[model samples]
Target: MNKGVVKMDFSEEKILETALKVVKSNIAGAKVCKPVLASFAGRKGQKALTIEIRLDSVKLKYRVEIKAAVTKSDKMLLAMTNKETGLPVMLMTQYVNPEMAEELKQIGLEFIDSAGNMFINQPPVFVFIKGNKLKEPVRCAIKRAFKKAGLKLIFALLTTPGLENTTYREIAVAAGVSLGSIDYIMAELKEMGYLRRRVDNSLYLEQKDDLVRRWVMAYPEQLRPKLTLGTFRGPEKWWLHGRLPSQDTMWSGEVAAHKMTDYLHPETVTIYCRPQKLNGLLLSNRLSRDPVGNIEILEKFWNNDEKSASGELVHPLLVYADLIASGDPRNAEAAEKIYEQHILQLVR
Candidate 1:
C-alpha cells in the first residue's frame, strides 16, 4: 500500500523482468534485452539466462541468475559462477540487502535488484548504486541446519574427524546443543544434499567446500554475535608479547591470522575464552573495559580447545570467518592465505 513499495509473489522470470524495468528507469538511454536460456560448454551442460545491455554505442552481455533474494551465503556461489562462465555474472534479484550488496561489490560481481540497486563496472559505463529500499520483503524459509545452533553442530562435524558417524547423543554433547536440535538439523542437512547416507546406515558430509563457505558466511551474522562477551582496550600491540592467562582462552580473528600465516600485522585483537576466563584474560593482557575497544572478547563456542596446533590460537576456520566478516579489504589477502594453506585440507 506504500507509494514506493509493491507486493511481489516472486518467480525467477518475474524477478528478472521487474529488475530489468528498474535498470531501464534509472539509467537513461539504457536498453535491456529479454532474457533467453543459454547453455555453456564444459560446465556439465549448465544453463543460465543470458541478457544484453545496450547504452548508446556500447553493448555488454552477462550470464544472469535471477533469484527472489540474494543473501550473504550466495556470494561464493555467484563468484564461482562467474569464474566458470565465459561472461561475467549479473544477478537479477527482487532485492539486494546492504551487507550482501557490499560483499558482491567486494568480490567484483555485478547485480541489479528490482529496487534499482546495482553495481556494473565496465569500460565507459560504471554504475554503482546501493541503499535502495526493497519494494517488498522476500519470503524465504530458512532451514534449521543453517541457524545458529546448527552452525555449532556443523563446525563440530567439519573439524572433528568421524564426528558425523557417531551417535546423536555424542554429537549433541560435542556440539553443545540440545538433543532435539540435532535431529532436525541432521534431517534438514540430508534434505539439502549436504549429508549423504551410506548403505551401512552411516552418514558422511559431501560438498564440504560449500558447507564451510556457507558456515564462514553465516557465522559472523548468526553465531558470532551471540558469543560476544565484551570489548576492551589494551596497550598497542599488547598481544605481541602478552600471554593468555589460561589455556581456555585463545587468540582469534586478525591476531590468529597473523600468527598462522605471518602475512598480516593485526590492527585489532580478538580473543575467545570461557566466560569465567574473561577476567583473567583481561588481567593478563592488561585490558580495560571500553565500548569501542580495539580488542574483543567472545565466549568460546567450541568445546574443544585443541583445534589448532598452538594452544594460544583458535582454529584457522574461525580466523578465516572473522577476517571475511570484517569486510575489510586489507584482510582479504590474509584470509585467502589461511584458506589455501589451512582450510583446503579439512574441506577436501
Candidate 2:
C-alpha cells in the first residue's frame, strides 16, 4: 500500500497520543518543552487550537517551538494565529492527498493528517508521512442521504425512534417528502453505515451521535432555508419569557433555546405556523414582512399534530438544531443542553 487510511478511530486523547508518538518515532530525542494554548486577547474567538507544545522538538539540549493544526484550513488559519505566539507548526487534517502532501514539504512545514499522512523537517529531523493518495475525487454537494427532506426524516427518527418500526409511507409523510425519497434516503444511510435494516420493516440508527452531528451541520445549509417562509418582526410583547401568541403556533429557535437552557438571553424569535393558519397569524400578530426581520415564520416541517408537552412549544430537537445552525458561540452552548435534556431523553 502506497499510503494507509488514517482511521478516525480514536478518541480525542488517543488521537493526541497517536500524533505525539508518531512525532517521537521520527525524531532522535524529541521532547515537549511545554503545552500551551494559542490565544490572542484582541481576537474574539474560542476556536484557537490549544497548542500543547510550547515548542516542537527539544533535542540535544536545544529547543524549537512547535504549533499544531487539527483541521485542513486550520493550518492556514493557525499560520496567522500562531504568528505572535512564536512557534513552528504542524498541520493535522482528515486526509491529505500525496500531491498536497508534497506541497507541504516544499513549504518546509511539519504536518500530520488523520489519514496518517505526515511530514516534518526540523534540523537533524526530516520525515515524511505519505498516505494513500486519494484515488477518486470528493463531491462538493452533500450526499443524497443528507438532502433537505432526509434531515427531517432523521430528526423525526431520533425524536421518535419508534419510527424505525413503522411504514415507509408514514416516514414519508412525517418527513414531508415522497416515498421514493425515503427509499433513496434509507439506502444511502445504510451504505454510510449509519443505519441497519431488520428482518421486519424496521430500520435502526446505528451511530446516533455521529448521525446527529452530520444532520446538525447540514440542517442550516440544506433544510432550514427551505422551511423558512420569511423573516419578519412581531410585536415584542408577544415574546415575553413565558408568553407566546397562542394561535396554532409553536415556539422555536433562540427563544425556545433560551427557555430550555437559561444559558442565553435571546434577541430573536422563530416560530412555526401551520400553512393553513398563516393568514390568521399575520392578521392577529400584525407581523410585518421584512427580509431582515428577527421573527421568522416557518411552515411546520414535521407532523403538525405533534405537540410539545406545553402546546405553544416546538420540540427541543428543533430548538437544538436552530441554535447550532446559528454558528454563534453562546447559541452553540445552549444547543448542547437541548441535545442533552430533550433529544437524549427522547432516545432513552
Candidate 3:
C-alpha cells in the first residue's frame, strides 16, 4: 500500500468504497456489489449499509455499520444489533488498531477498515488482516453538544425529564453554563438527529442511550480534565469517617461506586465540590496535596439542586463515567451494576 494521503468525503458511500478496494485487492476471487441502506424498527438512530461480498460463487451479505471511531462500549451494542437482526453485522470504520481488532474478533463480530485491516470469520471466507496503517487519519467536524460546556448542558437534559422543553435560561442554570450556549447546543443536537421538533414545536430528546455513550466517552477527554481541583493524599479509611456538606460536595469514582452498589472495596476516593469549598474539604479531611494521590477532587460542574436523591453521591451517570474512565476492570464491573440498577431508565 502506498503511504499517501487520500482526501475523501467521510460519508457511508465513500467509506464503503475505500474499504472494498482493499478487500478486493487483498482477497482472491472477491467481488464487490452496491450497498443498500439498512434500517431497523424500534431502533431510530442506528443505521447500517447492507453490502454484498462474493467469494467465487458464494455470496455473503453483511449489515455493514459505518463509524468514524469505535470503542469498547460499541462491542455490546454491535452484538445486540446482530442478535436482533439475525444477520452478521460488519463494522466499517477509518481504522481498527490491534487492541480493538482482537477484542472484536474474540466476540465473533466482523469488521473492515479503509487501512486494509480487516477480520471476517464467516465460513468459506475467513479473512483476517492486521497492522496496515493509514497514510493519514481522517478528521471530521465535532459537534458542539459533545464538547465541554455543551456536555454539561446535554447532561442536564439527559438526567432531567422535560428539561429540553424548558426555557434556555433554566437549562443554563441547571447545567451551570451560560444561557447563550444553550441555543447553539440545542441546534447541534437537532442537527445530529438526537433532538427533534414535535408538531407543537417543542423539542424532544431521542436516541438517549447512544447519546449517553458518546457523553461518557467524551467526558474524560473534553470536560473532566478542565474541572480538576487537585489530587491529594489522605489518611487511610479517611472517607469512612469524612464528612461532606451535601450542599457543596459529593462523592464519585470508586467511593461513589461502593456507596451506591456496595460492591468493590474502594482503592481511591473522588469528590466533586464547588471551587471555593476545596480548601474547606481538604482541611476538614486532613488531606495534603500530592501529585500521585489516592484522593482526587474535581470542581463541581453541575448545579447543587441537580444532585440526585442519592444525596452525597453524584448521579449514577457520573459514577458510571468515573468507573469507565478509570480503566480498571473492577471499576468497569461496578459500573455495570450502576448502569443496570440506576442509570438504565434514564437512557431508555
Candidate 4:
C-alpha cells in the first residue's frame, strides 16, 4: 500500500466511522461538528479513493474531502454506503488499456488515457417507481440486477439501433424479480397507467402512456423535415427535417422524457415539445448575447407555437414550463386536451 493509503474492506458504516474519527482527530476542539456521510468510491486498477463529507455546525456548514488509495474489493463497501446513505458512488479510472478504453468508451464510461484524453460515462437508464409505493428491497434488488445485467442484455438483443420492446420476463430476469411476482407488479403498473400490453403480448413500460412514446419515436421523424433543409442562414430556415439533434441534445431529451414519464403517469394524455431550433448565427450572436433572455425567448417561442396550434400539444416541455410559469398545466385534463388537439392537427 502507498503512503497515506489505507487498505480496508469497503463498508459504508465502517468508512463513515473512520472518517468521523479522522475528522475529530484532525480538527481540534471540533466538538460541534456534525458529520454527514455523503458518498464514496474505489478506483478500478488503482488504490485511489475519494469520499464526500458534509460537516455542519452553528457557525456554518462546510464540505470535507478525504482522499486515499482504494481497490476493487473496496467497491462493495462504497456500494453499501450508497445503499445506506442514498448518495451516488462511482468507480472510475483514468488509466485504462487501449482495448479496454475503446470498450469503456462504447459503453459510455467516464475514462481517460495516460495521455489525458477524457471521456464521460453514460448513466444507466433507470426505471423509477413512484409514491413510495414499491417495496424498497424489491426495487433495490431490481435496480442492482438491472445494473449488473443491463449492458449484457443490450448487447445480446442488438437493441442499440432501435427501441427494444422488452417483456416482463426480461425485466424480471434482469431485475432479479420472481416470475410469480412479476404479474402483481405489472398489474400495479397497469392500474397506474405506467405500462401497457402490446398486441404481441409483450409489456411496454411507458414513462407516461402514449405521450412519451410519441415524442421519443416521433422526434426523429419530426426532425426529418428540418434535417432535409440542411444548413441555412436564419431562424426562418432552422428546422431539423432529416438530421438528428446533436448527440447531447438527443441524449438529454431522452433522459428528461424518461424522468417526466416516470413522474407524470399520464394515461390517455401525452406530453409534447417542439424540437429545439438551432441556427448558427442566431445561436452564436443573439442567443449567446444574453443566456437568460435567450432561454426566455425560447420559452416564449415554444409557448407561441403551442398557442398557435389548432389542436392539443402535450409536450412536457411546453406543459411543465407553463405549469411552473402560470399553474395551468397542473390540470391533467386541460394539459391532455391541449396535447391531443395539437397532435390531431399534426396527424391530419
* TM-score top scorer: 3
Q: Pull out the clashing pairs in model 2.
A: 3-131, 3-132, 35-52, 55-65, 55-66, 56-66, 118-129
Local accuracy of candidate 1 as per-residue lDDT tens digits, 253-280: 8999988888899988888889998888
Candidate 3 segments exceeding 4 Å error: 1-17, 29-91, 98-110, 122-125
Count of clashing pairs, candidate 4: 35
TM per candidate comes to 0.76, 0.61, 0.80, 0.22
Task: Look at candidate 2 and tell me the lDDT of residue 87.
Answer: 46
Ten contiguous residues minimizing lDDT sum, candidate 1: 1-10
lDDT of 2 by residue, 235-274 (tens): 7756764334454578888888766677778888888877
1 or 3: which has the higher TM-score?
3
lDDT score, residue 4, model 4? 24
lDDT, each prediction: 0.78, 0.60, 0.78, 0.30
Off by over 4 Å in 1: 1-107, 121-133
TM-score of 2: 0.61
Clash count, predicted structure 1: 0
TM-score of candidate 4 versus the correct structure, residues matched by position: 0.22
Task: After the best TM-score superposition of candidate 4, give how far the Cα of residue 247 lies from its true spot, in angstroms.
Answer: 16
Clashing pairs in 1: none
